[model samples]
Target chain A: MTIHHQSATQLTRIICAGDISAYEVTTASLEQIQAENPNLNAAITICAEKAQAAAKRLDESIGRGEIPGPLAGVPIVVKDNLCTEGVETTAGSHILRGHIPPFTATAVARLVNAGAIIVAKSNLDEFAMGSSTEHSAFGATKNPWDHTRVPGGSSGGSAAAVAAGWAPISLGSDTGGSIRQPASLCGVYGLKPTWGRVSRFGLIAFASSLDQVGPFARTAQDLAAALQVMAGHDPHDATSTAYATDALNTALEKDIRGQRIGICPEWMSGNGLSTGVADTVSHAIEVFEKMGAKIVEVTLPKTQEALAAYYVLAPAEASSNLARFDGVRFGVRNEANTLPEMYKSTRGTQFGDEVIRRILLGTFVLSDGYREAYYRQAQRVRGQITHEFESAFADCDLIASPTSPVIAPLIGAQTDPLAMYRMDEFTIGANLAGLPALSIPCGYSDSMPVGLQLIAPKFREERLLSIAAAYERHAGQPGVAS
Target chain B: MPDITSDDVHRLAELARLTVDSARVETLAAELSDITEYVQVLRSVTCTVTPSPHAMSSVRKDEVNPSLDREELLNAAPHSDADGFIVPRVVG
Candidate 1:
């Protein structure tokens, strides 16, 4: 297998034109991923055989004179947390090191059915627990732009794989900032749909209230295309909305004419965003303004309180969701003298430091004496924030902000846990409010990429994608972007 | 004073279903006190007694859905045979 670099759409065009076979593209993508992944550490697991077989099937379909799908012969990567039948879905944890799903996740299976080849499973913070890929039990995925720095996580591997040309597009989950943060750092387009926009059935739960599966790609068009095929209401996941998936490519055709944009007070305050990030976001807003969009100053008053509420809420939900990992069921186990010992041994031995820390904090807040005072109070604040967002949208069509408060922090410079947790301040509120948001690379921080975020009301994904896809042509992130 | 004791650590660990080595219990107890103190920030937040982060209610259905087959559910065990998940037997 000789490795080469080509976009997913480009590969499909090639196969459509009979320039190459799907098998050739899959083999080349795997070979290229293998060659670069050792340095990138983006791929948590590679499934070359399954990918090749799938490609063979696509080729067979084409040979039979049947019309191929839009993503036919295109190879893609997926985050490790989404289940793939017969393939290990470790979620970057030691406990599920060899755990394979009997059935594929609804979203992933739908992607396969749409004819996109699943090439690899990307690394993440174990259980999507941290902003940095450093928390991944398997090891950190490095920024392809500069290998010494992180690829921003827990979808770091997915973003890095796309940015590094290991894959043209990838699937990721955002609980808080997992998908967008990493996409920002890796210089790609990542979108987390409104809380219920995408199906979450096959995904291993993290913070259940905040978790949303999304797509990552080099171009906003690719992200939109991948999302169209991957999103929809699954009767299995009650939270999924009933909207028909938006044809992401249509917005690029409609043009972003008269699109109204807002640069919120939370985004403009340089205190939170780095100088480079702030400057680039401002420049992007300027570009949008020149392109006939109105920019306004909007306030998200509850944003400051989001970090605290998320800290309490995410951990609380995670603690409950993760309780299912007890050794008596599956995963790693240690002999316990009692039934309680089974729970003790599984989480104690299997969970990484961050996961344990979150669980501890979660349990503390949800405990009897503190339940009303802590968890209940945090929920109240979250409600207020959601209301604030609904009101903010009344003033602006779409809210724009810098994705993270700052550029990617140095790999191990984090000595304070609270400071590390604050990294998701700008991005988490969208998740908290169950709103759809996209992070597209607007500029760079030194040599690394930075993202500008656009958020829209729930079910207005087409508008959000149209606004984002318009900016796709004039500028593309350099060095690291796929 | 909310200075948690080793007894408190043992209890909270049990509530959390976590295993803490004897050597770490004393340290954890000390850390828990400081954390509990830090967590007092939540008390300062005033609200209308209405719980904030509303639970996603639509997740549950009133209709009782069929559970996964007992055989398949048990088969998900790491170490399973025809009848059950084989764990270290605990006998009093």
Candidate 2:
């Protein structure tokens, strides 16, 4: 197989064994990125020189018989929201167009420390506010399956890059389906680890509580391998968990027989769920049953209300988290006479429309008169949703549903703001409840891939991976879209 | 649900410190109203449980570590000097 076709696990083994040099793999990845990025626009920044230098160093270390890290010599892509020291991290917003962070995000630093070379920074929706990647300041990423359609967002570029064979693994942050929905549209695997599974030290914050950094890969094992390196505690981030991540790689190889897979009928036949996606996910359940896995019908009545709650809670947090971007500090500055004028002009002009809309909505929700009615009420609902998921997990090991309600829509197709928010109907519950969730390609609909979402209780990423790996063994890896 | 009027949008823009163009205010008002109406579903559901923030079980000792280079951080600012970041005249 060509270097681009090999998974990260395969590439590492070949490089370690001295059969193929890391330089060869890195060059092939860079070449593919250069040739295909123009048509797809999946990557915003390409680090050819730095990637080549890093790959050459790995080859030298291997030549000397020294062991590099577990992910030695694998080329990876990171979503632009995660900071890479001295590299321009824009978070897909013009406000940070030329801002180079002074420090690296803990998750990205961990991957790099493990010998993974970053080939590029993928695109995302501005501040991860929108479900469709069309909200990005640097143009929309076209779906690899069909260019006319979007690849999903705000992590659309990361998902598209993996789907288009630019990289085997990429990192993306999920606020509300930013990772999983795009993974579904692009026909790849994407996971949003439990809220504190990965550190958020240097990730440009959209919603502090809802955002979790995870990986996108073409193979389930690649997802596990990437997570094994990225997960764990970071002292810099207080919210990072001290839980053990050593079992992730081993868990994927275990048998999934007799595992209880929960199916929620309300979500399965929920409003606006496309018939194509519904049928594909239902078939996935049958396949699990055929493989000796028990399928249980579970009820999560409050989950349908999660979408409304998330919209309120996320935007409310965004207003506060994003308040740091005044004209005086880092990022773009608009010259003005007064300091207050500078803050107003800089934010008003630099932030995109969606960002402004979100900030306004956030401000309104948290406003004095409406706080009890909207913001506090949303928090109460968020608590209830978490309780609902906890109760449902007692009957099942994992919950299964459609990752996205529909396939990738045409660019500019979902201009209505409310319509765009509904794209995350099935996926927001996981984020609200702070659970580990993943999307794996189950089948194709309308010649495009559909994702089967598996959500597990907090800190249970291993179980999700084990079942995903088993399903991949049966369903086969999705064909690369070129 | 009460309709989001132009005055409401103006007030929100003022509070958020964002300048909205005259051309866009009407559209913003309509969109915000529609979203507000949609989210009114939350009122139908009762949630009496008190929301507890996620537990932070791994907070480290409060010790000062080496910070980033002062020059490097100052250099990223739009206006900075040997002393600190410079902003528009506020006290004058």
The ten-residue window of minimal lDDT in model 2 chain A covers A299-308
DockQ of each candidate's interface versus the true one? 0.40, 0.79
**Candidate 1 residue spans exceeding 4 A from truth:** A1-4, A246-249, A477-482, B1-10, B21-76, B90-92
TM-score of chain A of each: 0.96, 0.99
Task: Please give, as one word, the docking class of candidate 1.
Answer: acceptable
**Best of the candidates, lDDT:** 2
lDDT digits (tens) for residues A404-440 of candidate 1:
7677777887745566776787898898889999998
Candidate 2: lDDT of A41?
Answer: 92
| lDDT of model 2 at position A348 | 94
Instruction: Give lDDT: candidate 1, residue A79.
Output: 95
